[model samples]
Target: MGYAGRHVAALLQSLGVACSGTVRNVAVAPEVIRDAEAVLCTVPPDEDGDPVLRLLMKQLRDSASLRWVGYLSSTAVYADREGGWVDEQSDADAVDETARRRLLAERQWRALARDKGIASSVFRLPGLYGRGRNALVQLAEGRARHVVKPGLVFNRLHVEDLATAVVAAMRRAEPEALYLPCDDEAAAPQAVLAYAAALGGFEMPPAVAWDDPSLSPALRRFYAGCKRIDSRGTREALQWAPRFATYREGLQDAFRG
Candidate 1:
């Protein structure tokens, strides 16, 4: 059902939900698609477009039992707001090539759901961190970076928050909905790194300018745009609130555990 199929399956199993998973081949096994009550797609778009949609658009469209379809998209779809606020309704004219493709995929998924008359939602998520995936893990393993870009802010969401939002969206059975699922506070990259270092009892990594020659091109591109994501529309629609509304609370949980 997703790229991180095993992780997702484990999470659902812990919640007492019987789940099955597949990686990158849901199209070949129509039975899996047919048997699924809901399908969550977490794959990223390629240069050609959404691989899942390209492969299984017909199967998904023909799925009579499919009650809900959720696509995990990125808030990068939004244009660079320069640390300003963007909500579900904001303009999504992203200049980045990957972001543009993501936006296209979002529209395609929504259109498919609309045509099939099924409940569907697209989640525009920010940088995701939780459990073993947070900054603490990075800092502990000596992989953390303090990339400094002044006046830049990025929102993040715990993986658990995303799971909660998905469940809420499914239960609500809302069709053709767009949501931004993010934490309460938006902060700079260095701030998160410093906080995580403090929580992990490690020295803060020295700041590196975004333009430093050692940075990877992908990392540089990640810091190219700055924006704060707002999830109020999603909160009101799903009646869901993030448990870890800020990086501080989330990092503390990770550190303690």
Candidate 2:
């Protein structure tokens, strides 16, 4: 998400629009965001990988002077329906502890905009895939494992699309808007990995099930997640199209070099 923000921020700036990026829990260098107009925040691993939104609302409310505040949120805030599809209108269950914590933060930010009159918006993004972060690259290089879990699927968006949606949110400058951002396809873990390897012009590597007891708990939890989400709203509202609409498309570019 951080990398995606840089791409979008630079794009917006190149178009003659000044942009500001806020960093949470760190000393932001003045030069990183000296020229500013709108503020886009993609702060995380939220103070231990999930900071409550109240802290940010207080911090943001304390500082003002921007046309809009764009919050880069995650679709993990949605409930785990075990492969069932979820949309922006769906109720978020925040199944695991981390997601539950993220949900609380989202509620706080939404309230800050609605009741307190802060010009804010929420962008719930699906699983992100992009340059240097491609799962196949990670798996092939031994940084990540590709394990399939029953009843777990993932929706993905190329970072370019995520960045575009964020820019669209900022462009509209809506006082309090919520949008679900995702790509055109939802795929299983093995499917995503195989596609990446295919793009690399290599045969798909074999992998064990996530249920294999040899796996670590953290990896197991990550493999257990079902990243199903809908993004009709982004296309309708932003009038934006992704240059890399699918992970396959983006993965090809990542390995092309």
Candidate 3:
């Protein structure tokens, strides 16, 4: 959560928004957000379930002042489209364990809002990348890998664009809405890395087979899926588009930073 929350908090604070506090611990959410009118939950679900809903369901349901509730979810919840496009109305047949759990958590939040009449918005985010977490940083630290896999494509969102989308959602206070926020372009990891290398003036990292035994389990899982995600529905609904429309622009921004 620290990855996106800290950047988002900074952005919100700069916009003159009155943010009470960033809730680092779910157990203390009730106290931290006692008087908040709008709340954004970026907490990830564990094996048990969504920690925030599990811990602060009563407090959230009881808060009369709470108007807008936003839950940050992932695009992994959608089924693999084999490099095809998927949108908000697409089939959400989550195959992996993590995606399955996230789907359950999303349902829980939507149901909670319905039962309590709270304006709930779920933003299904794609792979996130920004200043300190982009290909530039990865290549600078010599940790960038070019995983060679045919027909593999991924959609990514710059953290700043995500921040913008979330703030727009807050302004509209859309009730019981689902959105998928991603950049305009979806490409392979190698293509992104090559672009980053050109900007950083370094040779691209050596290619690694997608099935290399040295790859971590998490990376293996990431490589297992190939899909192109589209957020046109979200853009139309929120009247917002990604500032960095593709990895090329996003990586350039990070490199400039």
Per-residue CA lDDT of model 1 for 12-131, tens digit only, reads 778887777666565456778877888888889887668888888778888878888888888888778887899988988787888878988888888888888888988888988878
Which has the better lDDT: candidate 1, or candidate 3?
A: 3
Task: For candidate 1, report its TM-score.
Answer: 0.92
lDDT of candidate 1 at residue 107, scale 0 to 100? 81
Q: By summed lDDT, which 10 consecutive residues of candidate 3 come out lowest?
A: 20-29
lDDT of 2: 0.68
Model 2: C-alpha RMSD to truth? 3.3
Please provide TM-scores, in order, for all candidate models, with all chains considered together: 0.92, 0.83, 0.94
- Candidate 3 per-residue C-alpha lDDT over 131-241 given as tens digits, one digit per residue, 9 for 90 to 100: 899888888899899899998888899999888888888888877988898998888899999999999998888899998999998998888888888788889999999
Q: Give the runs in model 1 whose Cα sits over 4 Å from its true position.
A: 1-16, 24-28
Model 1: lowest-lDDT 10 consecutive positions: 1-10
Candidate whose lDDT is highest: 3
- Deviation in Å, model 3, residue 256 alpha carbon: 1.4
Residue 24's lDDT within candidate 2 is 48
Best by TM-score: 3
TM-score of 2: 0.83
